[model samples]
Target chain A: MAEVTFDKVRKAFGSAVAVRELDLAIRSGEFVSLLGPSGCGKTTTLRMLAGLETPTSGAISIDGTVVNELAPAKRDIAMVFQSYALYPHMSVAQNIAYPLKKRGVSRADRDVRVAAVAATLQLGALLDRKPRQLSGGQQQRVALGRALVRDPRVFLLDEPLSNLDAKLRAHMRAELIELHRRIGKTMVYVTHDQLEAMTMSDRIAVMHDGVLQQFGTPKEVYETPANLFVASFIGSPGMNLVKGELRAAGSGLAFVRGDLSLPVANGGTAGAAVTLGVRPEDITLGAGPFACTIRVVEPTGHETIVMAEAAGETLVARAAPDSQLVPGQVVPFAVRAQRLHAFDADGRRLPLVFAQSNGA
Target chain B: MRNRSLTSRILLNVLAWSIVFVIAFPLVWMILTSVKPQFELFRIPPTILPQEVTFEHYHRVLVETPFLKYFRNSVILAVGTTVLVIVIATLGAHSLVRFSYPGRERLAQLVLFTYLLPSVVLIIPLYLLMVWLGIANTLFSLMLAYTTFALPFALWLLRSFMQGIPQDLEAAALVDGASRMEAFVDVILPQAVPGIISTALFTFILAWNEYLYALVLVNTDEARPLTTGVMNMLITAFNIEWSLLMAASVMMSLPVIIVFALLQKHLTRGFGAGGVKG
Candidate 1:
């Protein structure tokens, strides 16, 4: 029920800065993810929020009270580590009841509450079993049960699903979403997985090199990434970025390369170096103004990811599974006019204005 | 492959049994000698089995000497030193592993450095300290000296073991509303049981078999452990009672063997997983 605020937070380890100049505001009951590659300072930020690591500078407040010096025990936050980190010596019931017992709940109350949580997690049959005796998914549930039983002000999860198998991870992702909806706790999840962040978080804070690149809704961050890094990192197969130059055509502007010219709603200095960004799904194959030689065709049961080469740069486009794309076949390609994202040589996004449709 | 495996297995068994026999021969001979009469003991090539068993040496050790009193003193010294060393070492190792303070790494290195020093070099300073404390020739001096001698090694061993325990368990405890101290007692301490058991065993054995300090610090049988007291039996100017000496050695070793046998299971138990997937 508490909103978390990080005001210019920074963390450093012997001058090797792990996280720096992070100013983030997480709304009450909102699920926010600090998503980035490893060593991108997502875990450091989460640790700072968990009171495990103190900010080298700046203030961190929870529900309007500054917790700069508050110990983790006093912070009323529960975290599920990348490793579930269940107490190996305790039984499943004892593991779940740990937080309540620590809070000085009596034996009778502890048992009742633990039993209820176990039932909620479908772990009633495993109350007496040790953690090692449980399967990976079951152990994950016990870890979740431990955090859920506390009903803490905030829940921080650090790559909780990265260990599970693919099917279990997908199942757990849905369960986590339902759990967040049910509990409505302010959860700040840290992971290198963009899919996890995109699917689960109300707001995704994409970070790189210890800096927040973009923090917005999944749709906003995916559809309108802030920079080259965000644009390439947010989507599957990533956004195709081709280094080229913007040129004034007849009436509007066109992104020009060697043999391909894309109509873009563009505004950049003429003949200046630019990077053209577009999503795979936004490009239509089989009918366009320019021809592209297909290099690879990957049909993943439902959708096809066709890697096509044009202007000496390969671009991946998502098409229908039955598109029957083949290698060495030159196909016509046309990108949606408004879907074009142009970045200058400095890798900053350039504002694009809609141009007339030049291809049918 | 199966035939080759069986051949290798037989070779291993033969090697293992031969090594065991080599190690156990002395203990077996001592036990046999303890029950043998003096005539049989002094015979040519020494009788492998006792010709006639006798309880005379056992009776003399129990009634004619201060053997029981020396045993009691040894028990008190060993147990007291072991308890003290374990408590101090566990706390020291936990702090070294978990807390980050100035010179913490240097201090941890110092623990191993101290253990590397020979006990003979430290005996003079330890004896002088005991005399300064006015506790010379008392069981307290021996206990204190044994604790100091064993503390460094115990700290080093326990520290290595404690480092293997993931800090996440304690962090989980902290987030669950337990104080740092509470988390240590409830989580960390319980996980370190095998380490504590090993340190206790090592320190107890070091104190139990310690001869130099016991000989230098304590003269009277009232405060002497078995190592010094058993050696005193040999320095007599008369006929050396080989049976009595062997019997005393066997009795002194029985407790250590029993303690090791009882706790050996825990020493090998694999709780290293901690249920955490890397």
Candidate 2:
């Protein structure tokens, strides 16, 4: 096992900076995911670690050795590509044993190691099959086996489950977690899927537009996001953000938009603009002062996604499926005041002290 | 959504057969003429089937003349040119497709631009260079000239084919402890087999059928390829051995047909997507 550190790494292509000021330290045996949308440079960062792309500036180290100048073959790392990238010309056994052969392992040793890996992956019967002959999930297992058989210093996976079906993706996610637990090797995964990042990674580095927005444990990011982007990006239906101005009220301050006004506890300057954010699960369904006309209600068996419009901004809130909420109906709602988040005009989360409004 | 009627199907079959026949008729006529008696070729209406089929022309091509020697020379030049073109083109195209350094785009463009220049324009300077090297009228000159002409197109085709291969495969290989050159030889080259085969075929045919370079570069039968050899036969045989000339032409095309037949299986192997779902 090895710890990976990126010391202010930067990558630029022409004038476009694909990744910049990327400083991250992954502890040994920790599962970390570089999570973001497309073109967010997560893959570029992973490639830099893989030694496929050299950083424009700064250094990367593995186990205290600066590997910035090392070739990928010398880095003692293994990566599983998003496309599964198994050598099409070789059988499954050969694909898995490729790294051992490259290291000049004996033929008998290579075959034994390959067979053991295949057994672990339940690919014994498929050792002789070509990659194209296997199913998508099977091919993915073979790719995983190829990476696992090497037992490299670090394991890197680039959206390895993105190509699989949803059912298989869930299955592989569990397998990957168990595999990580069994091997306890440092793994750096890259993906745009937040669910995968949230459920699998010990820490998730949320990125946007090639910049890291937040880096923390999944619980830390979900409970307390760093910025507006992180707040809205982390949760499932996303956090509902309503932009308004904080104005002086009778006893305290209130967030006031065109027609909607809610008393908020804040010490900011009067007339200062602020965004009020709350997750959908934190919003309650009935018997509260605030009201909105439900525009759409989707019942997905267990829960209902209730999208409502308030002061010309759409807010999605989740309720129980049996709540009997319907479109075009007004429903009284209340956000959990303690769980609410506030942001300034610059989209940075504001640490505000809430002053009770006496239910007014 | 219904299928075509019986008559329309019959009509389409007839049309397809007619097109195939139109394309094949010339080669069919050449093969028929190669086995005919010498005088039967100029007979009025030129008999479709020879009254007496004879192996005399084949015998003459194989025994009476320097045909076999010229055939060997042609084989050497064509195979040499093909080998040279594929090796240089594959490496050059791989570099062009995968790497970026100074003048990369310009070099790629130059390769394609070189292909656009007609071989006639290059022949004079090439001939002078060959003479300066004191290799004029040699098979090496012909082989070198063919390689030069074929390299650009071969490079262009292989570059496009290489570009279609995902960069991930090589990256995966590198991560698996294979060096860059090893990845190329073990991973990229095998995936490019079909393109390489087609490139070999194209270069071989171009070299085998080339007339201008062979005629301009070589004079003696020792260096002359099949294309120039056939012309030499027409000029020197005095008797105008039409049947023997036709047999020589037929023999020159046989190798190409056999090469295609042998490599066609790989051409249809579907590439298997190289482990990429898309």
Give interface RMSD, every candidate, in order. Answer: 0.6, 0.6
Query: What TM-score fits each model?
Result: 0.93, 0.91
lDDT of 2 by residue, B1-278 (tens): 13558778889999999999999999999999999898888899869988999988888888988888889998999999999999998899899989989899999899889888988999899999999999999999998898887998888778878887878899999999999899999999998887888788888889888999888888888898888888787657357777888888899889989987888776554233222333
Ten-residue stretch with the least lDDT total in model 1 chain A: A351-360
| Candidate 2 lDDT score at position A304 | 93
Runs of candidate 2 exceeding 4 Å displacement? A249-267, A293-295, A309-313, A326-332, B1-53, B264-278
lDDT of 1 by residue, A1-360 (tens): 999999999999877998879989999999999999999999999988888888999999999999989999899999998889999999999999999998989999999999899999999999999999999999999999999987799999999999999999999999999999998889999999999999999999999999999999999999888899999988898999988887887776777778667665546556778888878998899987778899999989899999999889889999998997889998988887777787888888888654645553
Superposed model 1: Cα runs more than 4 Å off: A250-253, A262-266, A357-360, B1-23, B37-48, B268-278
How close is chain A of candidate 2 to the true chain A, as a TM-score?
0.97
The C-alpha lDDT values of all candidates are: 0.88, 0.89
